[model samples]
Target: MAADHTPLTRRQALAALTGAVLMPLADPAAGSVRHERHFLFGSPVDVMLRHAPESPGDAALASVMRGLQHIHAQWNAWKPGELGRINQAFREGRSARVTPALLATIRSAARLERASAGLFNPGIGGAVRAWGFHDDVMRDGARPAAATLAAWRDAAPSLAQIEMRGDRVASRNPRLQLDFGAYAKGVAIDRALDEFAARGQGDALVNLGGNLGAMGATGWQIGIRDPFGEGLLASLATQGREAVVTSGSYERFRMLDGERCTHILDPSIAAPAQGLVSVTVLHRSAALADAAATALLVAGPLRWREVAQRMGVTQVLAVGPDGRGIASGALAARLQFASRDWRGRIATV
Candidate 1:
C-alpha cells in the first residue's frame, strides 16, 4: 500500500509476500480474524478484526464501514456532498453551516497548518483543481500555465483565513478553497479504530490505502515500501494504538509535458512538490501522522528534521529524489531492513 500503487490484487499480494503480515491468533478455535475490503475516497479501505466466535465483529465492521461512507459523503471535495456545498458558499461569499465533526476537522487542520508553518495547507483546493488533480481521472496534456500558477501563489490562500462561528463557517480569502485529501483518510481510520475499541474489539487494524492504524496485545507488522522501486525497504512493528502513514510522489501522479507531476501541491510554489520522493511518520494520532508526512515531504531532506521537531513527531523516515533515505533515530531503532543493501542513514533528531 505504501508504493507500487498497483491494482488491489497485486498490491495486496505484494504486501502478503513481503513482511506486512497480520499476526495469527493463538487459538484458532477460540477466535478468527475477519477481513474485508471496500472502495472509498478513490482508494481501498481494508479492515481486519480478530474476535471471538460470539463477538459482534461482523456487526462492528459493518458499522465502521457505514461510518466511513458517511465521512466520505461529507468530506469528499469532488462529489456533490457537504464539502461541495461549503465550497459553493465560499464562492458565493456566504457562510455555510457544518456538522460538529466537520467543524472539528477544519479546526484541527487550521492548527496543523499553523504548526507546520503553512507547509501542510488544505486551503489550496483551487490550485489542486488547476493542476487537474480534482477529478478521479487526471486531466491530460500540458500543465497549468505559469500565469495561473503565479496567480495562485500570489493569492497565498491558507486555512487560517477560514472563520468559524458556532456551526457556521466562512472564509476571508475567496481563494481559500478547502481540501482535506491529505487529512481525511487518517481521521476516518481513527474513527473506525475508536469504534472497534468501543465495541470491545480492541484487536483491530484499519488501513486506508497506505495510511493505517492498529491496536492489539501484540501489534501488527507494517512494511515501508521503497520509494524508487517495487520492493519494500524496511519493516517495523507498531505498538498499541499507533498509526503509520506515508506520503510519496510514486503514487497519484500524472505525466504532463513529459514530466511526472505528483498530486501534493506546495502552497509557496503553487505546484506539485518536488525534491523528496516520500516521507513516513508514525504517531498515536493517524490524522497527525498523515499531515506530518505531507509536511515533511514538502520540507524535503534539509528542512524535514526541523519541521518534524516543530510538529513534535519523533519517528520519521524520508527518502529523497535520489536513492538516499534518512530516518529519525527513534524510527531507525525500530526499523528492520529487508536487505542490507538499503541506502538509509539514521539521524539523532
Candidate 2:
C-alpha cells in the first residue's frame, strides 16, 4: 500500500502499539545525535544528524524543513499547489509551465513508470480520488462502481503520454491526473539529505514515514516493520548513502464490506493491488527505492523478482498474505531477524 497522505493521530497510536518505530540505534561515542520530527507530505518525518556541532546542525535541520515545505507546496496533489494547477491545465487541454525541479521529477517518474511496465503509475490521480484515497481520512464504504472502474480502464492513463517541451508539459491523455504520493516522500528525503550535505552535515538520516535514507561513516541500524503483525520483522545496518523503503498493505487502507482495501492501485485492473502484504527495497536512490517497492508489491510474490530485476533493484524483501517472507540473497545476507524461526525463503536475484 501507499503511505498515508497525512499524519493520522490514530495511525500513530497504532504504530506505537504495534512497535513500528523507525529509530537510529543509540551510540554516544558516535557523536551527539540531533533529532527532529515534523509532518510533511502527509506523513511524519524524522531527521537525525550525528557528529555535528549544535549550531550548524540546527541550521541544517531548519534548512531541510524549509526545503521539505517547499516540495510539499509544489507537489501536493490534494491541496491547491502547483500540481493542482497543472492538473487543472490538463483538464483544460492546455500546457502548464513547470519549475525545473518538478520537470525533473516528472521526467524521472515517467521513466520509472515505463521501466516498471506501468505498474508504478503517477497518472492515476483520477482513480485515486474516485476511490476516496485523496481524502485525509479514508472512510469505510463500498468500492467504486463497475462503470467507474470501466471508464478508468478505458482511459488507461499513463505518464508516458505526458509530453514535455522545455518547461511546459502537456498530456496526450486528458484523463491523466498526476499523483506522486508514492514517489514524493522519497524525493523529499533525498533532497533533505542533499541539504545536509551542502551544510557539511553528511552524517545524517531522513526518515519520512517508512521511506528513509541515511549517510554516515558510523552507519545506522534500521528496523523493518512487520507487515503481518506487531513489532519488527527484521533489522539492517547501513552506511554511506542508502535508502530503504517499504510498501505495505497495512499502511493505508479502508474497510469495505468487512474486507480491507489498500490504497495502492494496480494500473492494469484500476483496482487495489493484492497478493503481497509488503515489499522493501534497498537502493542508493531513495526516489527509486520508494517507487521500486511499490512496483514490486504490485508485482506480487510470484512476479516480484522479475520486476525487481527489471528495475535494477537486487536487494529486496517481500512478504505475502500468508505471512511468509521472501528475500533476495543480497538483502537476506544483511537482514537480522527478530526470531530464529521466522518463516521466509531466500531467492537469488
**TM-scores, each model vs. reference:** 0.90, 0.92
On residues 244-309, what C-alpha lDDT tens digit does candidate 2 reach at each position?
998988888988777889999998998899999889899989999999999999998778888888
lDDT accuracy of residue 263 in candidate 1: 94
lDDT of 1 by residue, 126-199 (tens): 99988999988865578999998888888899887888999999986777788899999889988999999998
| RMSD values, in order shown | 4.9, 5.6
Model 2: lDDT equals: 0.82
User: How many pairs collide in each candidate, listed in order?
Assistant: 0, 2
Off by over 4 Å in 1: 1-13, 17-31, 343-349
User: Best by TM-score, which number?
Assistant: 2
